[model samples]
Target: MTTERKAARLPVFDRAAATPEQEAVLDEILSGPRGNLAGPFLAWIASPELAEHAQRLGAFCRYSTGLPLRLSELAILITAVQWRAQAEWQIHYPIAIDAGVSADVAQALLEGRRPVFVDTDEALIYDFAVELYGAKRVSDMTFAKAEERFGHETTVNLVGLLGYYALVAMTLNVFAMRANEDEPLPFNE
Candidate 1:
């Protein structure tokens, strides 16, 4: 009996030559996930591909009903950095910037420096991510601050962002998803 183990393939969408359906799904996913998948989101209908989940997550961030968009992105960025998922970090850094995370703050987070724009809300969110990722729960003080600044719905969404990105970071790392060789690291290493 032959027993050779084949290598696992990394999950990714070939953006250059995606099928029409795939392209459509990618577009809808990139657009954010408010659809029922019965329409434009059909491309991912019932699909369990990693890209699908990633798209759903992207949509969640884009369409989140609670947290401010930039804050949510910061939470995801923190998870990406802590998990050391280079691809995730690189891909989302621009999104974070677009969503209003300052370039310097994003760079510092990516580069392991203390955040340069530590306002009350930013620090609260950062601490929330750190405690949640580190302990799987929030301390009472962190929870209190989060509620004070963002209320309950945003707090719940923050937790959702953490869980989503944790899965993404682990998947990308295990698959050894490297950043495009041409793309520079999002921050100085």
Candidate 2:
């Protein structure tokens, strides 16, 4: 049986007829490290002010975070799984692989299985994200482990990164944003 896809709740930002504020915001994002306005930005552009702040926070979380790319991307994937956010998973899966997370790990996550993390740091990050999402707070012991392994600054940055990606996931889900028609959906749900 074929299923009809619902239309996106918001208008995808059109740069041609954009307002001055939209143009400026789009320009800022386009020139940033993330050259393309993919994922959340497609909906965020409608609210230029929110887009600016969210994109800035996202840039810092994605690029300037103290955690290594592998761990940061892992945290992002964890958030994607938690929220069932296909856009987040699709965009980050390749980056995560290149950053050292194995296909096994990504596959397990997408399958809702417990991924056997060979990297101790990946395991620690997975635990941290699980607690943060499941319990709404990390245990003191988990926090201590993260702080010990990553130091206070990096640990704090890891927490910030998870929160930022959760925001991204929510935005994509809210707008029903997704990958191209030809791209397979990451989650079966």
Candidate 3:
């Protein structure tokens, strides 16, 4: 008996075949902090209008939001795990660590275990994100603590960051995006 294995594929659009609107959106993304079109952008470009709006919103959530990089990346990591988004996890894991999330925490998360956080803010963000992901809403205590630690604007941004990364994770999953061959799944499943 013979068995067949499917080859990995990524459904990327060719800029050479792009419509004017698609070209414009691609240009905007390439010119932004992203400095390149990759990952979810490749899939999103299929609908230029959606791409434009989503990329802008993503830029705000990733770059302009009041949440620090570590916190935002923490939220993104949680979203990635919730969605089992290999692409998102591959891209953000190192950034999360560089932004000050501990390696132990990241590893524990990847192992599908609760991370031991040494920082109060890290603990708060982890609890808030996990509760939100698991319950679709945080408990009043978690919400109150997040609001107190992060303040109103930052708290709102944290929610937005979670939501934005969730969208990214969904896009990557729907498109069957794959991480590089060398990069293993960040979570144990």
The per-residue C-alpha lDDT of model 2 at residue 165 equals: 94
The deviation in Å at residue 61 for candidate 1 is 3.5
Cα lDDT of model 1 overall?
0.66
Per-residue lDDT for 16-74 in model 1, tens only? 65666566666665465443221112223224365566676656754674777788778
Q: Give the winner by TM-score: 1 or 3.
A: 3
TM-score between candidate 1 and the true structure = 0.71
User: How do all models score by TM-score?
Assistant: 0.71, 0.94, 0.91
Query: Candidate 3 — number of clashing residue pairs?
Result: 0
Task: Give lDDT: candidate 1, residue 63.
Answer: 65
Worst 10-residue lDDT window for candidate 3 reads: 1-10
lDDT at 20 for candidate 1? 62
Error of 3 at 85 (Å): 0.6
